[model samples]
Target: MRALIAAAIGLAAALAVVLTVTAIGAPPGETSPKPLRTTVPEHP
Candidate 1:
């Protein structure tokens, strides 16, 4: 029982470290400006 609890704690700690590292290294979202749309005549 003690061994199982220890293993679980170790696994949780490893996962937490991995998640923290990934979150910190992730890229930022797009911030570029969009082009303006011009009105065009409709064709029949």
Candidate 2:
């Protein structure tokens, strides 16, 4: 039970990080299903 809870917490944290970075650092037009692995560009 403890292991399961730890795994869940880890997964949640990882998901939160991904979402935070995507929402904050990603560009404005990443709604499609192709560019899920985009990198931060140099400038606008």
Candidate 3:
């Protein structure tokens, strides 16, 4: 019973993270100025 509750909490946290990141980060597309995954390192 405790294990099941823990699993549910973990799943909720994972989903929250995914949702937050998705909301904050722009999707990779032609309209976006930068790509999601860039090979070049930041100089600054």
Candidate 4:
């Protein structure tokens, strides 16, 4: 019974660490902007 409880606690801790790391490693919004399109002229 004690072992089971310990294992659950360890699993929860691992999940929390993974989530925190992933959140921190993600890039912030608006870091990369989209390019604008330009019209091209036709040649005769």
Candidate 5:
């Protein structure tokens, strides 16, 4: 269980680093490579 938790934390850290780098290097006039966004439906 300890090992599993460590692995999950490591993976999350690596992913965050990669995403930050990608966002910084993204070219102007282009959308983000991965849109970390969510949308909600409108109600009447």
Candidate 6:
């Protein structure tokens, strides 16, 4: 029972870390290669 409780706490902490990283965007050594296009080009 105690082991199960500890496992659950560990899982929650891992999830929290993942969520925080995702909220902060890309990590230090990586970045987006291209900027997003917000508008469509006019037809020829």
lDDT of each: 0.90, 0.87, 0.90, 0.88, 0.89, 0.92
What TM-score fits each model?
A: 0.56, 0.56, 0.57, 0.55, 0.57, 0.59
Q: Over 4 Å off in model 3, which ranges?
A: 27-44
Q: How many residue pairs clash in each candidate?
A: 0, 0, 0, 0, 0, 0
CA displacement after TM-score superposition, residue 10 of candidate 5 (Å): 0.1
Ranking by lDDT, best first? 6, 1, 3, 5, 4, 2
lDDT by residue for model 6 over 1-44, one digit each (tens)?
99999999999999999999899988568567998889998899
Q: In angstroms, give how far residue 16 of model 1 lies from its true place.
A: 0.1
Q: Write the per-residue lDDT of candidate 2 for residues 14-43, one digit (tens) a residue.
A: 999999998888666746776664887788
- Cα error, candidate 5, residue 33 (Å): 28
**Which candidate gets the maximum lDDT versus the true structure?**
6
Instruction: Give me the displacement of residue 27 in model 2, in angstroms.
Output: 8.2
| Runs off by more than 4 Å, candidate 2 | 27-44
Clash list (residue pairs), candidate 5: none
Report the C-alpha displacement of residue 40, candidate 6, in angstroms: 47
Model 5 regions lying over 4 Å from their true place: 26-44
lDDT by residue for model 4 (19-43), tens: 9999889776665487665877687
Where does candidate 4 stray beyond 4 Å?
A: 26-44
- What is the full ranking by TM-score, best candidate first? 6, 3, 5, 1, 2, 4
Candidate 5, residue 1: CA error in Å? 0.2
Q: How much is 28 displaced in model 3, in angstroms?
A: 9.1
Return the top candidate by TM-score: 6
Q: What is the lDDT of candidate 2?
A: 0.87
Per-residue lDDT for 21 in model 1? 91
For model 1, the stretches where C-alpha displacement exceeds 4 angstroms are: 26-44
lDDT (10s digit) by residue, model 1, range 1-44: 99999999999999999999998996779766986659786889
